[model samples]
Target: MKISRVTARGFMSFDRIDLELNEGVTVVTGPNAAGKSNLGRIIDVARLTVASHAGSQRGNRLDVYERAPRHGTRRFRLAVGIELDQPWEQELIATFVRAAYASSAVELPRPAHSPNVSAERRDMDARRRLAPESVAVLLRGFLVIHYDEGARPRWRASWHHSSTGDLYEAVEPVWIMNLRNGGPLMRVKQEPSAPALSLADAWRRVFPDDQIDARTPMPEQLDFMGILKRLEHPISLRTGAHQDNLPLLDSVRDLYMLLGWDMEDARRGQVDFVHVLDVVLQRACVLTDNRRLPLARTFPLEAVGGEADLEDGSQIPCELYRLKNGPLPLRQRYQRIQARFTELVGTGFDVQATPDPERPGNLLIDVTVPEGDHEYPIAFSGAGRQEALFLSTLLGGDPGRVIVLDEPGVHIEPTLQRRLIQAPDSTTQCLVITHSADLVPVTAPGDLARIVRLAPSHDGSQAHRIGHLDPKDQTRWLQTLGPRDVRALLFSAGAVLCEGSTEVSALGTWWEGSSNPPSGANISLIDVGGDKSFGRYIEFLKAFSIPWVAIADGPALRPASDLHQQMKKQGILTATEPDSAEPDFDAWKAFWAAHNVFSLANVFGNDGTAAGEFEAYLKRLNLELLSQVDKGRSKPRIGAAFASQHPMPKEIADLYALIRDRLQPARLQDAQGEQA
Candidate 1:
């Protein structure tokens, strides 16, 4: 059961946030202090919380009061609304432990200095989207959230939680995963103990008949980590303590009893316990949890041998580290060994437990890393590698489970982080909360990929995503931006870059109809941030094959002063319509203003009107008109008489009209006829 949405109120950074999750892979991104990690932590808390007053109504017991919202006349109605595709809509809520008011959390340098405080804090809004069935399983059934507030500079984290909800059952055969406790490792008050498997309960009993695939090599059979997890069950037959090194046969027999395996079948050589185990394990596939925690792949060979290719398209060179192992053909091996193991086990191969011959070492048959080597063990790599390996072993065993990864890139290289995102898994869905741009989809001019941006808010944290982007302003912004930072986020604010923030802030102001005197218009606008390092960002967007746009100002030209030409040379801006002017250096200020629909004052001659002191200089450009109002500062009243005489407000209003006249393509509209 994947989580369709995550809501946080009175949680770290999140006052009230609603984020829609994607089914397969949802990448969460933002700059350093944008609260990416905190946002991830909220998800961790939502899925793992126990009944409490802290985060969700089901928040962790210890931090319950700490994360609960402040008591209000209305209780502040802290809740995260989710729409699960598989299970059905179920109200998932958690109570906040504490809450801080906007006025209290933010110290206004000058209370009256700023006249545009939004009713919604920067991070206290909602980002909505529909939930896919695939993602539902991952969130509710199997989840891996990896966050590292653990180590400074670099964090390593992995987390997941599961509770039987209607969402889990819709996806059959694939059972929900158990709670994953890899977090801050906080020790909280223990409540009632979870119930052990009841041997007497017939319904609880697994297959009465057991059969082990005896022909399978010991190494190959026991090679997969998933093979061991099934063994993590309670033994119902035997009452004695589990052995430290019990004989394989005896242990299987004992577990058989505990699980309520038929005793008659065991004596008759029809080992029902082994049969059940084989049925559960055979042909089933597991996926690596490469998000928060990666996996490891190793070969004992020390010498460097040249290339080796196995009937597949991939080429593998022999080395101590084969970063790419390529996919292993499981079917071929299974077919080859089925007969041999069948003969060896005789009648009841399910009886299990076969001793190895010749070599004293345990027979871990055909245990080899697949061509797709996603794991990195620490002994060879580092502590982070070890952590990744452990996490992979724990979370990668099931494709049906949901995985939540908080800062999954901790200790991971940027390129590898990208690869982790690239790994293939059809059934498993991934929710990755990461600070690494490398892991984000490599966005182009117009790509859409699930991305969520979170930031601290006046009251709490807020989120923004693709679906929430306003159409009117957003369309124009995309024309300028090329859709780079705009992501198909589960829940997030559109991506924010140093310069991009300026536009988003402007858009936010304009969209809310509060551009000081108010733009007196509604526009869809979003920002596609870029920096010296857009390569990584671009790679992320492209990798996910997402559509988006990235907008940034071009560098100023000094000699030629050809702003357009210079920007084109820098690859910052590409003009569909080439400028005849080679180069003319405009001050950064001038160019920025121009992009914002403001014409330099010198561009228009004054028709001779008393210029507001602030716009006095601007009169030189538009003597009779103000190209663009300086937001709240400039008085836009003179147009009353100008527009009265003309069909439209000549200089300024005409331009505004021209922009408004732009007709968008039909596909851009939402189902409701609004811009999507």
Candidate 2:
């Protein structure tokens, strides 16, 4: 199962947010403090709720609400939707009241003395006494296995009082209901009571005939904490004598512990119980930026030489061994992981966790790469290679789990960063929190990858999933751009979409020296290539709701027919074309004024000299470097020269005035919005 959405109210930095997620890979990005990390932590909270249980106290994972909500509110609600490979949507909800402490004791029901008292009656009595919210921890799901090995597997639905209207079946046709008590087992013959009736109503519409039978066993109540501690054992078995002490129907591991596991010395086995048990819980794995391998344990070894002995006269194995004595398959798995890691880091680079040569019995990892026709340790290599090797170690394990990566690309290059997330064997569903544009794909229509952009909204972060980019816009952006360029465009408050590189260069140079550069006002300069690209990018910007203005050559020099058509279609332009060397500025200005835009005609005055674009205007100004333009002087050099010219041209000064005046108000509004 994978998370499809997360809805939170009063959770860190989110006043109220409903974040939708896509299957497989979803990249969540935004400006810092827009709650990208908070969203990832929310996932962490959900994973902890499902994976770990409170041992001696109530679960503290939901303690995110310890502080008041955003804007000094009380209480918090979190809902997570998990998809089970079908249209089926399973939801987990956690609600916290300010006064409730994690240490608050929840009493377990005492065993009935009289056999006349029905187990169902005792179970209901216990459930009614517990808080509805505390029971949500048990409402995740149940792994139902038939005691009879040959029976076909199925899930039955029933409803009882639950925080999120959850129902989990322990076995076919035998649903577990009313999880408020440690292990309430009662048949749902009539309508479910109170809070659960709402869930029952929804369930009936989908599966009307679904019913809970009494075939499932009823056990004496166990404290939520006690149940957690008891299941820490490698194998928990319910035998013929323990039918009355069943486990809570929250996780597969708990279910097996409730039933029976007679495996011989399972605790000593290489595979962990949690790994096997997590099959039903839909395990989630998290890879954070600070990920590190745990400290290795050493074992006593026979001394190869007198130098191998420690001061205490004891020798320990020097080999940095991982699963060396485990099953052959386990050893092979690590080898494959090493191979894959080598492939990702680059050819001729490999990591070896072997015995330390000089310090016998001490484990050491040698990062080797071919240098000067000989292998050398990568510790002598650059930091980038070392970082990549470290990250690769984490990926050498299992695939097909829910992987959450926090800024996985922070220390890597653009190419490797892309490859990090796009690993071929990444069957795992990944929720990546990142600010790197290289990691954010301008995904095509119907692609599995999604971009979830978080922007500040009223003291909280608003999440917008960019489902698709206009094919034309994407094509134009990709024509001559990389991730960094696209990221700058995505993050900028507003933009100046101009004709070509010359205009971009000129604007950039001028903006740099000018106190009020477009960047200062959170505006960016995007060269949309030529006339056709300009039109496409404009449409793209509009589609993405990005505020933008166009700076282009006059109609005489480069008539943007596509842009003209678009303007007409949007009812922004109504005037007919004028048959002249220059455009009819009066009519065009009136139409373009409402939309933040201008052309060369609006900025510069034409002196009947045939000089039209930037380079032509530069030559008209009598710049000497224009003579060696092809050989050495380039657009940037020309732009730098234009910016340094004393007594700026009247048209150039006018352009700056227009940009300053227009972007100031936009910057103010943007600032206000961010503060909100």
Writing each residue's lDDT as its tens digit, candidate 1 over 91-151 gives 1100000001111112223244334432123112100111122223222322222222223
Candidate 2: TM-score?
0.61
RMSD of each: 23.8, 12.9
Badly placed stretches (over 4 Å) of model 1 are 51-61, 64-377, 383-391, 443-447, 468-676
User: The CA-based lDDT of model 2 is what?
Assistant: 0.47
> Candidate 1's C-alpha lDDT?
0.33
> Which number leads on TM-score?
2
Per-model TM-score on C-alpha atoms: 0.34, 0.61
Candidate 2 has which clashing residue pairs, if any?
318-361, 318-362, 459-676
lDDT of 2 by residue, 1-676 (tens): 5555666766667777876666667887665456777776665554434333312121344344244245544445555554332211111111111001110111212234522323333233333322333333333433221111122211111122222333321122222432111222233332334222221122122222212222435533323322222222211111111222543212222223332333333222222222222333333344354342332233334422222211111121122133333468646755665676567665555445556666677645454777777887665676556556555544554454556677777667888877776663445577778767788755444332376666655446677644455776456545433446755555555678777787787667766666666666667787776665655566545544455777766542222456666665665555554443655665555456545667655333345543546566666655664554435667666666555653456676677677667655445545553322
Residue 115, candidate 2: alpha-carbon lDDT = 29
Candidate 1 TM-score versus the reference: 0.34
lDDT of each: 0.33, 0.47
